[model samples]
Structure formats: structure tokens, C-alpha cells
Target chain A: MLKLDREIRDAIVAHAKRDHPDEACGIVAGPEGSDTAARLVEMVNAAGSPTFYEFDSTELLRLYREMDDNDEEPVVVYHSHTATEAYPSRTDTDLAQEPNAHYVLVSTREHGNSAGPVEFRSYRIVDGVVTEEDVTIQE
Target chain B: MAIEVRIPTILRTYTDGQKSVEASGSTLQQIVDDLEANHSGIKERLVEDSGELRRFVNVYVNDEDVRFTGGLETELSDGDQVVILPAVAGGC
Candidate 1:
């Protein structure tokens, strides 16, 4: 199970809504070994396609260096599925190299940019295997 | 020439959990070969059978992306730092 702060969850949903018709991707970094998703680092979607999302290479390097300097790790790696269910696609599972991260998928298919509920789910993708897990929001 | 290679968490298995290791090479390809010589099966993850860097893997030499610096043929010098990171990517 993944415990996420309520505000961060809302922020992720909002980001997904804002980027509707295009995929949005980012990571929440926290102190190393903490497993607590504390810092939400929004990233630009270099692919900028509804069916794809990739962090810019330069930005990716900077992000990692910052995390390393702070002794942090990406606790939650998230992306939005603008038109699909909140689940890992074959591409997601295949390229997910972060074995210790909580892969969060937010699906905006039902409501698009509207204020209705969206499917927010979490999973663990490791070694080409994806296992869904529960997400508990905390105040 | 000794180059310091920083390994990502996912590829730490190849470095026996050491975040960074030292290898010798005058070019990126030779460094990879040296890495494989010390850590078998790691070259396959960084380089494809076609001998090109994997699409989802990013390699940097002293903060410059190897892609723009001749890729596998990028020259290296002693005390250079190399960092390898898998692309943070996916799609639906």
C-alpha cells in the first residue's frame, strides 16, 4: 500500500486534468529509504503526446542530481492516461526501471478536464511484472 | 585512463550495489567494455545487440549527454565522471 498526502493527490489530479489530451508525467521524491511521497516534482512531458510521456533528458539528469544531493529517491512516479484506464500499458511495464517506486496512473478518460472523479491507482512494476496496490490518502 | 561511472539504482546489481565504480577507457565504448569485463551482463542492458545505446538509456560524460557527443565513440579522459540513467518514460 502507498500512503500519499491528500494535497499531493489533488495536485496530481489537477495536473492530469490540465494536460488532458496529452499525457502528464512527474515524480514525487522523498528522503532516501523513507518511502514517503513528500516532494512533488512536476516535469515537462518531452513526448507531449496523448499516448506517450517522457521527461526531457537534460531535466531528468538535473532532477536526479538534485535528488542525489538531497539524499532522496522517487517514491512515486506518476503519469496520466488521458483516454485509457488507470493501469500500466505494455510500454509502461516494459520501460519501468524503478523497482522501488510506486507507479501511479491517473486516468482522465471519464471526465476529461471536468471536475468529476478520475481513477487514481498505484502499482509496483518490477522486472516486467506489474502488481496493483492500494493507495491511502492522508490529510 | 580511469573514469568514474555512476550506476542508477536499477542497475546497481551490476556494481554489486555500489553507486559508483571506476573503470578504464579512452572512449565510451571501451569504458562499457571495461564495465562488462568487471560486471558481466551489464553491457547488454546499456548497449543493444546493434551496438547502439539503448533508446531508453541515457549516458552522460561529465554532465554532457553522450548522444550529442558521438555516442559510444565519445572520448573520455582520466578522472571523467560518467552517469547512466534509464529514461523515465511510458505511454498508454
Candidate 2:
């Protein structure tokens, strides 16, 4: 089972909301483990709009270097669907280079209402395949 | 026994917003056919004109990948979860 922290979920929702009228993308950093209770270290935006997400491999490399410098590894990568549900599209599957990393998708449609609840789901992409797992959110 | 198929977000519009559904089949292709019987346009979204999985789509069984196993012929069992994920291209 995949586990997500409440804060992470909120962050995903907020990021999706912030990018309303378009899609939002980012990365989730944490320790390497199957445990869903891992603490989120950071949320880095892809930097720009609905048509494209620029993942600065250089920045990611630097961050990875820093993490290596600190003896840690990046755990997961996350992004959002502004007009759709929390599922991977064909484009998403094609670009899933990190088979070991968790792929989290947040849906921002229903959350438009202040009273509406946010919808988020997590998955694992391995060898170009996407598998959805139950995500347990921790407080 | 029938296998349980999980629908991804993008295809939900064709499935009337269903996140998961049940289909009777022993292989991925059969399951997809069963789904198309109930919901039109599903197979089109998942497959190309030549019957290949779309470039942006990924189907997984449990934690294993269907492509590495057998593509459309991958075997299935009752209660097994099949996840359909399409590559998401939109982002800022």
C-alpha cells in the first residue's frame, strides 16, 4: 500500500489549485522505503503552465547531489490534473523514468468548492507500467 | 471468475466517471473487450489503429508490468487489480 502524509496531500491540492485553468507539476522528496509514513523533505515546482512542465534535470541533479552529500535519496515524484481525475495519462507513462519512485497524482476539479474535498491518488510506475495502490494519509 | 479492472482518470469520462470496474476475462485484451462492450470508446482510447497500446499508456498488474510479462496476453486472476495509467502531458 502507498502512504501519503496529510501535509503532502494538502501541498498537492494547493499546487493544483494554484495552477487552476491549467496543470501543475512538481516533485516529492523523501527517504527510500515502502513505508507510506515517510516524511516529505521538499516540494519542487516544474516551473511554468498547462502545456508543459520543465523538469530541470540540472537542479534535480544538484538536489540529488546534495542529498547524496547528506546520505539520502529522493523518494517520489508528484504532479496534478487540473481538469481531470488523479490518473496517469499516456504522456505520463511515457516519461516515467524512475521505476522505483512513487508517482502521486492530485485531482483539482472537485476541490473548486471550499466545502468540496480534494481527491488524490498514488501509484508506482515500473518498467513503463503504472500501478495504482491504496494511499493511507497520515496526520 | 471475472477480473477487476481499474480505470484511470482520463478514460473515466467514457466510463461515466468510474474509477474501477469489473470485467470477465483471462487476459488483458479480453478484459478490454469486455469493457468496450459496456462502454464505447474505451478501446479506442487505450489502443492505436494497429491494436498496439498507445504510446502514452501503461497498464500494470499489481506491482508488475504487463509489457514485461506479455502485453495483451498477460494472464489474470480473480481479485487481481489492473491499473490503467496514461501519460499526462499537461503541466506548468
lDDT winner among the candidates? Answer: 1
Q: Kindly list the per-residue Cα lDDT of model 2 for residues B7-89, writing each as its tens digit.
A: 75457777887868888888888988999999998999788899887755667776465778888888888888777765433
Off by over 4 Å in 1: none
Candidate 1 lDDT tens digits, B14-92: 8899999999999999999999999999999999999999999999999998999999999998899999999999998
Model 1 C-alpha lDDT per residue in residues A1-139, reported as the tens digit of each score? 9999999999999999999989999999999999999999999999999999999999999999999999999999999999999999999999999999999999999989899999999999999999999999999
In candidate 2, stretches whose alpha carbon ends up further than 4 angstroms from where it belongs are A33-47, A112-115, B1-92
Q: lDDT of all the models against the reference?
A: 0.97, 0.66
State, as a TM-score between 0 and 1, how close model 2 is to the true structure: 0.53
Q: In model 1, which residue pairs have backbone atoms overlapping below 3 Å?
A: none
RMSD of each: 0.6, 13.8
The sequence of per-residue lDDT tens digits that candidate 2 reaches over residues A10-126 is 866776677764566665655444333344544344555554544543344455446445544446567767667778777677666555567778777776524356677888876
DockQ of 1: 0.91
